[model samples]
Target: MPENTERDWVLPTEIPFSELKGKDLEECVYWLLDAMGAKDLEWRIGGAGGGAADGGRDLEAHFFEPDEEGELRPQRWWVECKGRSGTVESQEVKEACNNALAYEGIDRLIIATNTQFSNPTRDWVKEWQRTFSRPRVQLWDRAHLERYLSRHP
Candidate 1:
């Protein structure tokens, strides 16, 4: 198990997503991102166990990609770790999207959920992209996260 891992690991799948809740889920996401080389990560809790709100974002990360001139251009990403039993609603993502407007440098919005997103939310993101294109959206549903984690694990 990773250093931040809260429990023992099982073979094949390793950590079971269903058994995790609240902060545990957030920690898992953080660990996965850390393992994958995302830098400058901040774990922000919002309205859970009486913690102050985090403006709809759960984790924030920074990435640097070389530009055409070989300059490292910084990209900021806001990650929301949603541990849901059902499909994630659009409002949740919308809140995070809208919150991005209040910040200056956020260039990407990553919605990482234990469950899949609602169809309406997908449509909303598509529509949202057609208008404003600054913060590229990346939806890491359960299967997507599994694929990424399984490779690193």
Candidate 2:
């Protein structure tokens, strides 16, 4: 079992969508992102009330590398947050992966969903892991979520 922190790994039963908008989702995502040790990160929580454009990615974090401009440029780290009760479908995962591929200089794509991915989606992830050498896209389901939350909270 994953460790429990000040804030436990909440299911949809604990916190519904009505509660997880804006600051609530942002706080959760921030904890996970920090636990992941993401540097130079920027996040937008719960692609609702407007910010769902530029693909379905919830957070657009750019890990910077020194460029010729002598300034840190955004590297690809398009994060899609699915804080839903239902298991994520394969099509959504595919769409996020495709978006990551389309973005310039994205080193990786992270799909962070509160629920598990469908079996087909898990298989698809395995295939992508084998196929993609650079700019790989990976899935992080509720287990990962709980682990991170446990560490932080």
- The lDDT for every candidate, in the order shown, is 0.80, 0.67
lDDT, model 1, position 30? 89
72, model 1: CA deviation in Å?
1.9
The Cα error of candidate 2 at residue 84, in Å, is 1.8
> Model 1, stretches more than 4 Å misplaced?
1-14, 46-51
Among all windows of 10 consecutive residues in model 2, the one with the lowest summed lDDT is 12-21
lDDT by residue (tens digit), candidate 1, 1-153: 657858765442555767655688788888888887788989987664634588768899888888899999988888887787878877888876777777787889898888788888888988887887868888888788788878766
Q: What tens-digit string does per-residue lDDT give for candidate 2 at 97-144?
A: 766766667777787776678888888878887777657777877677
> Which structure among the candidates has the greatest lDDT?
1
TM-score of 1: 0.83
